[model samples]
Target chain A: MSGCDQCALAGVLPPAPTADPGRPRLIAIVGPPNSGKSTLFNRLTGLRQKVANYPGVTVEKRLGRARLEDGHEVALVDLPGIYSLSPRSEDEQVAHDVLAGTMPDFPRPDAVLLILDSTNLGRHLMLAAPILALGLPTMIVLNMADDLRKRGGEVDAESLTKQLGAPVVLASAAQDQGLEPVWRFLTECGAAPSPVDLPALQDVPRCHAWAARLGRHAAYQPPAPPIWTRRLDSILLHALWGPVIFCLVVVVVFQSIFSWARPLMNGVQWLIAWSGAWVGSLVPNTWARSLLVDGVWTGVGSVLVFLPQILLLFLFIGILEDSGYLARAALIADRTMARVGLQGKSFIPLLSAYACAVPAVLATRTIENQRDRIATILVAPFMTCAARLPVYTLIIAAFLPERPVLGPLLGTRAAAMLGLYALGFLAAFATARVLKSSILKSERTPFVLEMPPYRRPTLASLGLRLLDRAKIFLRRAGTVILAMAVVLWIVAHLPLSAGKVPPIERSLAGTLGRTVEPVIRPLGFNWKIGVGLITSLAAREVIVGTLGTIYGMEPDAKSRGLQAALRSDLTPGGAVALLVFFAFAMQCMSTIAVVRRETGSWKWPLVQFSYMTTLAWCGAFLANRIVTALA
Target chain B: MQANVIRRRAPASLAELRKGEQGILDRLDLPEDVSRRLMELGFVPGSPVVAALSAPGGDPRVFRVDGSEIALRHDTAVRLKLRPAASAAAN
Candidate 1:
């Protein structure tokens, strides 16, 4: 306790909370978007954090437990970043509600960790006014202390603390420096101080002025803007080269996630198969063995195959986002997004949609406007994701010939794949336009975004983010996907005769496929393809694995080999229809589940599902007719 | 909103300020919420703003104000009335 110093704040503070053993003290971590609140939270909690939604909102709440230096445990609720107390979006509403103790299932925070960037205190400091108005025990965490000192910025923490009637500490979550004060603040005697005069909650200029005056009185020296930021922004935001370079970047990211991820995907696939076969060899010809290998292993493995790609995608997103190039990309995309009735912020999320719509939907939280966010969510699935890649590759390779479409420049197989991508992109763009002009209509949302200076991304932050994403993916695989696989295996093998599983035609799965065959026959699909379509509702890419199993079950399909099996089974028109159908169908249960969670209700996801499925069916029917006539 | 109520003779909107020029914000001529957000970002009256650069599409222009770079589209930036940096400094 030699380092403990409370001489200046002795009488001004109350004893810290968490003295009660039953209910741990809850401290709200609040800050602007770029304040390093998350970094601080990650540091304080380490791996103790769990992210869940705040009851029924689209924004997620991150709750983590941390232990103080004196061995007292406390819970930290990290709130979404907001500039002020006045709520404009769901993110702000969550923050405001949590602070006011009005949010359902959330306790009024015992204390507030007000994090602000020390280098940009003039602008970041305005958030202090309304927060202080909450009259809660608060400590101003001046984060990015290293950046502050490096940039020649300085502040007198004692003077600022006295001015605000709260204790202040300077720390850097990135460098992991000056965190000793944080541990002391939480564990030591710090309580709700006497209320100090602050500007009205809605009075922006007054708040700004008050914060500025306090900074000056505290001897705060603002850091000079970096010279390189301007130099970089010149070419990065240039009219011609900027857009060209942005295109190249988009192409590179797209290619890397698709092509560079191939070997890793193959590795994951091989591991799953080898383990499944090895485990299966130990079990006899019982249902348990079939269930173990075919149901759980194959089902989870299909989803897990995309893990490498997802991690790679998140790695790129984290780097681009943390290093601040995503903002520039968003600005460059604003004009094109405007054409589709969205804005710049929707660009990165939509680009990420091509990698996977699940993260893309989560990314929409960055857009401040509710209408725009919902609109983005609705259209995100129309961007063909990595889940659809295997289905596309299998079909295109088997059904289409490799004849050149434009001499040697383009092949028919490649052209078909590009067409599918373009089809999905057009559907997304058109749907967004329709949605904004109708249900999601709103007045103009001001696109006022702060351009943070580009900095090198930390390995810790990116690695931790990828770890979180991987956990979420694995959790999905272990739960819903694993269960679905088990159920599917039972359904396909049910109504056994003489205590033995029947053939694919006599089994329940065959009857199930046959029953739906008539409905899809007009689109040129048979019972085999119908089975693939039905099972793929678990996830789109499951169709590839299911088709492999389906043919393995039927007698004639096993002889022609797999690729030849598809070539013999599907007609030219049927193959094109299938491609068109997959392009528009909302077949992935995970995407639907994510949509439901993000939109806060079944209403939006149901509407999206019904509309997309209808479009897909109609599209498939039309493609079948047009192709059959051309042939 | 009083952000639009002219207390002083503010000359030009921020949109009209060319790149490489500086100006002092006179007031925000926007709705209450919008102006409030801008002011919180250091668009407060009497703060110096320099037109830093234009985006590739040339709609959302970036500006340096209060030691931070912020981007605002034409519709939002047009609402920010400013006094020429030369005139404000001379005054």
Candidate 2:
């Protein structure tokens, strides 16, 4: 009755009932960024939520089914956190479009659950006011109440409810308090009406002023000055100390990605090898055994072996992102990045690309400028991702001797590895500069970022993120990479030859490799290397597997035999050329697919692929010539 | 009193303030969307702001305002008109 009374007072009619009575009511959870909206959604939906992307965009749409206290179910959609309805960024536009019921895939929500941070009541309300004016059955959730209370701040929910004409609930999503009231309110509230002809909607200043006033009426008490935050920021944001600490943190993360993952990677490798051998014995037919063992097990397993490193990388990224340290890193890196025609915001995505480019490409969504985002994506793959590690380690082990460089502190092989990483970054920087100045030229947008107060990242959330990333990686391996592996296997085994020559040398892959060999020979790559290069397009790591399969060796953890064969087969110059080629080539199909999806065009991905391949060839030729001259 | 208030030198841009200085934000001279965004993040007129820390190269600095720290580049910070606090001026 009070909801309807408020609707009538606002001169708006209540929304009509759903066309299907049996269908569950739709509730949308919306809030500003870092307001704990996702935490609340997780609590409400638990494992019931489904993650998907909006049609034609990379923006995620998360929907879940939540059961109310009365055994009734309602559909809850977690919209992306946006500051206001006037959307500037694509992420903001998607959130705005979904809430306006303009996105065809999603219908208008029957009710709205607007989450507001109690600690920053005024700013949150600036966003809340626009949603409330939309005239839906809105409930204001004052989240982080526990944190507010700790700082001697209080919010009068009843007074806020009276002032805003919407039901307000004080909840601490992290502490899991005050959630039951949300379900009760949603169930009790019927179809909410749309606010019609609201004067505040037309004027931006009036809306802000009105929200500020409502914030006062709510008895909102601002939290005490964050002493701990200030103290930490003093050291962390220091002109000299900040960059040093950021570099150290990056070193630790990258080091851990390799060192911590080694044992687990070996375990995965052992399992794959054991299974491949097991399958080889079980299958009687040579072709069937080869397909199962070499195609699926070796090919997909080689890529999957990098999962531990990938998961570790995501975990570190999750902690950095959740604790709000990445923004500080961005601020520190902004000046250096500007020289390359990128803002500090591109720093995290480029750094993440070192772990894997797929997620890094997706992470570019945070960049508001379309041209900047595309430019960042265009150069992301050049950063030596974990996928390239296998090839690098293989080539280094085969070519470079393990001689101590810094009196046992560092070795020649280790130095070579560092050089490869540096090369990737140098290439990325040069590519970004070229792309920004030419193809994706735009005036620099003003850099403005909220430095969120640091908090302890919740283990539960971190674990969930790790699990989600692992799921996505495994899914890609199962689908795209698996299909590619099978196709490559068929190509490598087709037109069965009855001669003493190996099938791989006589198959379609062999002919294709031979055809391309002349073009690549200048770079010191033979037809076998050419074949490896072609299969590497599926994934960079697959080159190692493809080479193993081509050379008639088992691709597994113990790739020593393959390494020995490579050492005998390749000159040092050829080996360096191969490593250089893998370092710059746009070889990952997943990266290309994600780029196409992110840029919403085939044109950019094609350009990205061609330019990168050309760069790789040129770089490899130069490296080969230099090494050959030195030798 | 009115004459004295009028005679006070115009407020300096936020970019000119050294670290540890405090100022009251007068107005933002950025584009519409950007200024509105800055205001929404508690850069409203008359709010007390302190230059907290400068990043390496000192082009962008973190400013503490309304219990939140915001990072702004020099280009963006120059658009912020701020009246230095009397105590900060004395310091």
Candidate 3:
């Protein structure tokens, strides 16, 4: 393996993937939770990383090509952070599997970079015993060297290296300091190192004793944790002030997404319309021109218009998560969750579900209890995701006015949006209570969460996350929504009478919509609304795009905005029912597929879909009945 | 399920410790796997534990062990048996 030096010197030759035949030398980046592993991975790999899932599982597989200074390109995988090799949850199971070279598609690591936070070496050292036992060439990268130094913590790296029989490097990955040793280790440790005596992690008590003794022999002094965390916790986790502060945070996040993103969303909408007009002007107004302007532009643009709102949502969510505040919120929400038979850990996933259910379902991997995880996964889609924002915003803006209900702080529109969000949250809780008490019953798992020290989230990291999220959003708009739009346009114009387009009611798409209309008409939806619901099954946001394409094909609808076009066609009662339906319905195929893969069967997703759709039907019917009566 | 723990002997557990109080962890009176996890997190026997601020309803409380704050709910924390130490650490 050390012959990579010759491979490098073969002058402009591609670094041999000699280690794994086709794959580069695989090095697993292992760490304890919040051990600055990601910070280090990001620094080393920069943006060369590809984020994907392990084959058939929702667990993320983050692989990146890290160019060693010696011109050797190695593949670095960021394994799920775990306390030990003994698996406790699916996340730990995957990490353990990958490290053991049992995980499919991921080859055995030729070497390992074990990252442990330097400031908390006493406890973090427990990971070393299991990782070291694997007998791979390893480097103990003690991350957060700066924090340890600033807090007057001390560790004898020479003594530590001697005790652990592994090279130890003190590094502050964020500050780009003490990293030369890391580069040297990568090149130098190409050959397997001498195996050291290691305690099996399965004997947890013995393992801890071994780590504790090693720490003492190394003279590892745990850093003084920041004083401000306790001080802040006194107020932030206050009996009275905490809940109030949490509510205030949610409101502020909600209000800002609307007010801050309005101008941006409008800018996007204007750009989309301008481009459509520009493209339309150049080409003669034929069916091909219509396909480009009305079909592709309208369909994709309608979905694309919500990108600003989605970005803003992630911006706020990323801030909360990275700043360590979300951990506190989990603690706060635990009490509320308990009534529904879940713990605080479930709250984090449920909260993340508000952004999107896919990752939120993935997040349930942290929950140790199987029943609790299933319950959380099932209720995830009920937390109104960013995709639903397009539909909610369009309807609420058109139906509800801009007048403030709670003075200038809360507009009628924002209040209406909040009401819809609350509606989804309530439905989630009610469903969870039923599921927990009925079939998915289990004892409440121990809630043990490490409260990470609060740090100001860096803009570079936040910006990177936002960019990643934007890519996902735009990719969906380009692919699914674009294909659906084009297909819908063709269907709406089918059975061309005398080589001419027929009215929408006589077209294939319209006939299909009309067929489904009777079933949904009880909820006050027309055939167009029926069409939107049918397409929304692809993704929650596709309804907005479907409507955009549908109206774009109509002559009168072409003259006005989407919301304006919607208002003329839908009654206030129908609008409320549409909102309620989306709030409870499982509209995303991706989420269902993930549920299937995660549960390892279609049974749970089938039950979840049936249950949620039934709930949606009932809730939408009630809303329609009430709203129409009131109107 | 430990009968001795259910008998409620006099020794205080983490669930009973007040803010600013300190204790030494004796043994984890929990299921083997749960206790194993607790030990791995530096809650091993003879280690120091300092009480920290808790949540709003005070069910899940933060305890400082090995220079880190960990929030454990009463259901689990109550099972952490304590061996009283000589001096209480000043908060």
Candidate 4:
């Protein structure tokens, strides 16, 4: 089409609809891992995509609107990267279902965009062959074409297109080259041809041979590895140096999360306090004033202060994942993971659990084995997620002295924080071992992970990822945490009496706390702490907010900060016990709901909750006794 | 069959090969699902392979096969029978 004709067509179309009017023509993007499918999707859709879980499963699918040159819009889906059509993992199953037209929620695609890594064309086509045989109009994009050319490799796209009977485009997604050809092909390619003649899916060996034959027919030749890549792999994948470097990287990341985010956290806290004060002065009525300042501000502000730390944590994680170090880390961790009867692939999800169990549990879909996936999901919450950071920081700042443990290098508080994280990991490991030998016992699956070549992560992609994470966290705060805060405020303010007694002690939460007091007495918690613990079931971070509201509402405590109030009321032993209780407790309702949804049963979540609660109480009691004895 | 057996000694498992050693994959003595996955990752019979690197414990090692690096546990590696490459055998 001529440029003028295209412009005319674009102008003739009605104003673009805000949302898809009907079932828009579907175009699915499918590819193997590290083929730059996601990069291509990002280029095609920009910020117009929405990410949501598929119906009934926790696999995330990205849907966006792609406008053709004729101004006709089609729905573009970015499917999770998978190796082949044979469904081994949940993610692969989702991709397979959508292709087979079996997923009730998703329509069969009008075309398939099969992206292949030009540098590893042979293996990538093994996945492409099955997709092409499904009879959909397919366009093969040779991503990483620049990297191929730099290594003295050449691909004749014309010959490959003729051989496969599909349109082929050579593009470097990372360098942003050769995108116009893709759009042109999508706009011009109208009707899908009938399914190509292909050998039946008999066995793995047969599939490999077929793919190898296709590679030769297409004249696919992988480029020589760059000298620097070889040299770096020698050290990074070495037996002796690999684990050491990995441990050093982990240490640096954790230290950065603590030290780098401190200033930002303090600023957020200051802003919250300032706003609360400003709003407090405007509303003079005692009840409304207290509800606004003491209830909402103290409750929600405590959780909002943790946003900086969570962002920092995800930032480092994004770098590690994007730079391709996470795969190597998983390979190195496979040995230790095997000892616990888990596979190497479980490493990333479990490590991510340290950020938050909700996403970590969702990430378990990558594990192929059902038993292993469930095992990973079960023990994920044991890791100290970001929710516990607020509680740990509060307790450590209030109770633990900031004396240097390593003579200006590390402080006692830092050591305690690290120890808590280590404790979480140890508990998860032990739990995995026990569960493996008993209820979830199964044969060990082979660990075959593809280690992608490392590339410097682009700023735009990393910024987008960090922004996405921030959005999810803020959305949760806005909905679940905000609702819980309002409900908690009402609960802590009910049964108003005419006397001078504090409303918190006479409120519904007070009664509930007293009811659980006898059970928690041995753990060194009073009714107020018990109230915080009970409200924490909504979320672990809510404990901080709950305590803030409780202490904020007490008589003569309005001017004093929550931290100061906690220090005067709580003993050191009690603080340590509370911290230990929170460290192992399954206090996140969202985590529980995710587990139930993922496992397709409440049986597992109930079992998980009970066991974790038992462990938390026992650990808290021991911590209290030991600290009290030592003091 | 007897003459063919006498032409060469038994093949060595990948786990027994030291670093930098080369071998041709013979067969995998593993479960069907596991062996199938291994083959899909370019560990088919007659594929040339080299021991690339190992972890600290010397259990899970990275093996270079068909221009790609794969990490396998020692136990899994032992299940893959391989014939030592001619150059390595000659050396």
Q: Give native contacts recovered, as a fraction, per prediction.
A: 0.81, 0.64, 0.82, 0.49
Q: Which stretches of candidate 4 lie over 4 Å from their true place?
A: A1-21, A194-196, A278-289, A343-374, A384-423, A440-444, A498-502, A521-526, A538-579, A589-607, A621-631, B1-11, B83-91
- Writing each residue's lDDT as its tens digit, candidate 2 over A196-269 gives 22234434555556666776776778888667777888899876787789999988886887688889999999
Q: What is the lDDT of candidate 4?
A: 0.78
Task: Write down the DockQ of candidate 2.
Answer: 0.52
Q: Please report how far candidate 4 places residue A160 from its true position, in Å.
A: 2.2
Instruction: Tell me the DockQ of each model, to 2 decimals.
Output: 0.59, 0.52, 0.58, 0.46
Query: Considering every candidate listed, which one attains the maximal DockQ?
Result: 1
Give per-model TM-scores: 0.92, 0.89, 0.84, 0.84
Pairs of residues at least 3 apart in sequence or in different chains that clash in candidate 4: A239-B54
- The 0-to-1 C-alpha lDDT of every candidate, in the order given, reads 0.83, 0.80, 0.79, 0.78
- Cα displacement (angstroms), candidate 1, residue A486, comes to 1.5
Question: How well docked is model 1, in DockQ terms?
Answer: 0.59
TM-score computed on alpha carbons, candidate 2: 0.89
Clash pairs, model 2 backbone: A15-A193
lDDT value for model 1:
0.83
Task: Output the chain A TM-score of model 4.
Answer: 0.84
Q: Which candidate would rank higher by DockQ, 1 or 2?
A: 1
Ordered list by DockQ, greatest first: 1, 3, 2, 4
Worst 10 residues of 4 chain A by lDDT: A1-10
B-chain TM-score of model 4: 0.78
TM-score comparison, 1 vs 2, better candidate = 1
Give the candidate order by descending lDDT. Answer: 1, 2, 3, 4
RMSD (Cα, Å) of candidate 4?
Answer: 7.1
